[model samples]
Target: MLLPRIIPVLLHTKEGLIKTENFSNPKYIGDPLNAVRIFNEKKVDELIFLDIEASKLKREPHYELIKKIASECNMPLTYGGGINSVSQIENIIKLGVEKISINSSAISTPELITQAADRFGRQSIVVTIDIKLSGLFRKSYKIFDHKTKTTSNIELLTHLKKIQELGAGEIVINSFDKDGTMLGYDYNLIDYIKPSIKVPLTALGGASKLSDMTNLFKKYGLIGAAAGSIFVFKGKYRAVLIQYPSNKEKKLLYSLPYFIS
Candidate 1:
């Protein structure tokens, strides 16, 4: 079995790294570039930088900051926010981003995914789904920009599968319900979506500690784990440190049986 990956999820709000509860209250932490520098030195598996307000604010990603962060970090970076067109996607690549995670744009013009993956290769694309519970069995998937709300889970899943067939290398699933709460990831969503998509899926949201992470990796047989608030914060879980698991903790996570069921 492949060793599970530990990824740091950074939320960008007007150029600063911040944490939120249920994707609301924003508390400034530090400069994003500074966080990138520190993560680089620590040699984390990968870094995911998401412009939280870009989609809601209806603005393109901050290229200036993207370049600044890219120049300071050596880890593979995945970036998303305010991407709406093929040109915008190309512009982000020009800024030195390794992968682009798109949401609002995908909801607007899904053909764009095929266009991008076809031109840049599947490995360069990552489609992120920020979903929330809708009903007893249904769920809501959002694309951001405030108005980009899509609740057709079937359509959303179809889009993801189509993008993968169009050559998307991977998919990142972020749960809006669990985001920033540090409760734990929405495992049922991950499990439900996993079987339908062919590409590897990375689960994000509601991660608070090493145990939450271990349970996620072990319980779901997930190889990619991403968290934002859990890494940030210290103290009785102060929620500002933004650090990765120590080597020993990782060894413990990796030693779990491949199939927990």
Candidate 2:
């Protein structure tokens, strides 16, 4: 049986680490490099470093910092932000990173999904989608041009299908309304994407407790699940002390009948 995965998401504002609620108000956590060293010692399954400012500034990912991170950290590292081209993904893969994930760039340029997948192989490309709840009916909301705040998810079903056809290996469905709030994963995202794509999927945002995660395994057939807030903080207490469930807790969640069903 494949062991379920737990991942930590590190957000970067220029060069510092931060956290947020519903993707707004990113609070500085600490130096990202220092945090990586700590997670390295803790034996984390993987690390996701997303530079929130890279795309907004139209600058490439800070590869210099990435190289040091990949070298020092024992786990596989994946980095995103400002990734908009074929050569850029290739350049990052060459630097010892295991994968390259893209979101805003793929949204703006539809062809990037196919180009990156074809050049790097499907397994190396991860497509991340950031969504929010739109209206009283609780529909998924997609944002285009984060600067202008235009919103829609009407094109999402079609877009997800296109990326799957384009050879992308995995998808990460993130909820803008739930990030760092640690309430739980957006369960509806599973209903939204389950029918369109035949690829491994991971859900992030709103994962606050062990029951929240157990509910995810019970409700969704997602191949993997992730939470930055739950692994890094405690409920209402809101401390920076990092935590992960012991081996037994992981077994209970992974072996639940709902997970296999």
Candidate 3:
């Protein structure tokens, strides 16, 4: 069986690397380059760097910063935020980014997904959907737009189908409600959308322990498991630290039951 990709997601801002809860209350952590260096030592499967303010502030990606991080990173890198054009995608690829993740742009101008896939190959494009649970019962999932900070009327399954049909090679679903809670993933959310997804899929938000990843794999099989708080914080106090699963733990995780070879 193919082992799942364990990724550390770093949120970047003008200050530096930061962590957020429920997509609010950003706390400064440390430098992006420093985080990359540590992840390199950990020999992580892949890394995702998201410029949290780029789209909200209406500015371009920090190419210089991204270039520096990419150059220092040993594992494959995926970058997102304020990516709206083919030229920007080309330049980011030139700077060594393995994949470009688009959220806001994919909503405003979905044609860009096809355009980018055509120019850079579908494997180079990743579409991220930020979802928030709503309704009086809190069971409904809606697409949350980071730029506007509002939920759209679009249906979650409809949007997923649209992007996949538009040539998105991979899809990442992030739970705004679960972001940084580390309570474990919203399994109901995954079960809701899993059947509709055909391409590679990744889940981010609310992963607190290695066992959470194992449970996800045991239930769903191979899929990317990305987390922020679990990788950056330690213990009940949430002390700042940078770490990933060691090779020994990873071997054990893959050997756990329910995975089909």
Candidate 4:
């Protein structure tokens, strides 16, 4: 009986940790190291650190910073952005990181997924698919490219299956519109893509509250619930406060009748 994972996503720039709305207007949150130290105290299940500017700037991951974070992180850590080759993945893993997440590079070279998976094992590889709703009258979901900042003609389901077949161990579906919105998870998008994905699946963007996570678990059974804003902000004003559910809260969440055994 697999249990759902509650993960916090930390988006960072070279300057510091930041948060974005609709993938724009990156607001500085705090120091990345400080955030990690706090999450460590809270006993977070897993943590994801994405270099929001690495791929767009055409730079390699800040290995020194990653090494620091990896050394301090007490839980499994996944790092993304500007990861282009197996060497980079190996380097990140050697730094004590648990998983490597690829986005734009994977879009350009799908074979990298298989090669990295073969070299490091699929469990260490995660493929992130950023998606946005397009069109006028009837909006439809399309694959979004963070590097080009454009939607591709590729069908979403086709690409998902392709990534899984290419040996990706996990797939993270991120909503471009719901990013930083904190409204809720994109239930429709999950409904559409869940059936086609054979690998472990995680959903990011639009997770506002604990109920959002509970609703997601009730509906989907077993999946990774990853969020940025919900864990980093507090109160109606959205104050920059790093927090995670306490053990009591988590036990109650897991004890819900809808949660799978």
Indicate the TM-score of model 4. Answer: 0.96
Evaluation by TM-score, superior candidate among 1 and 2: 2
Residue 38 deviation, candidate 3, in Å?
0.5
Among all windows of 10 consecutive residues in model 4, the one with the lowest summed lDDT is: 252-261
Q: Give the candidates in order of lDDT, highest first.
A: 3, 4, 1, 2
Q: Which candidate gets the maximum lDDT versus the true structure? A: 3
Better of 1 and 3 by lDDT: 3
Listed in order, each prediction's TM-score against the native is: 0.87, 0.90, 0.96, 0.96
40-97, model 1: which lDDT tens digit per residue? 7778888899887887777767888888887777888889888888788788888888
Better of 1 and 3 by TM-score: 3
- The true-versus-predicted C-alpha distance at residue 122 of model 2, in Å, is 0.3
Question: What is residue 248's positional error in candidate 3, in angstroms?
Answer: 0.4
Model 2 CA deviation exceeding 4 Å by range: 136-140, 143-147, 256-261
For residues 140-210, what per-residue lDDT tens digits would candidate 3 score against the true structure? 99999887888999999999999999999999999999999988887789889998999888999998777
Candidate 4 lDDT by residue in tens digits, 1-261: 657889999999978999999999888899999999999999999999999899999998899999999999999999998999999999999999999998887678999999999999999999998999998899889999987888999888889989999999998999999999988888888888888988888999998777778766777754789999999988888899999999899878877654211
Q: In terms of lDDT, which candidate is stronger, 2 or 4?
A: 4
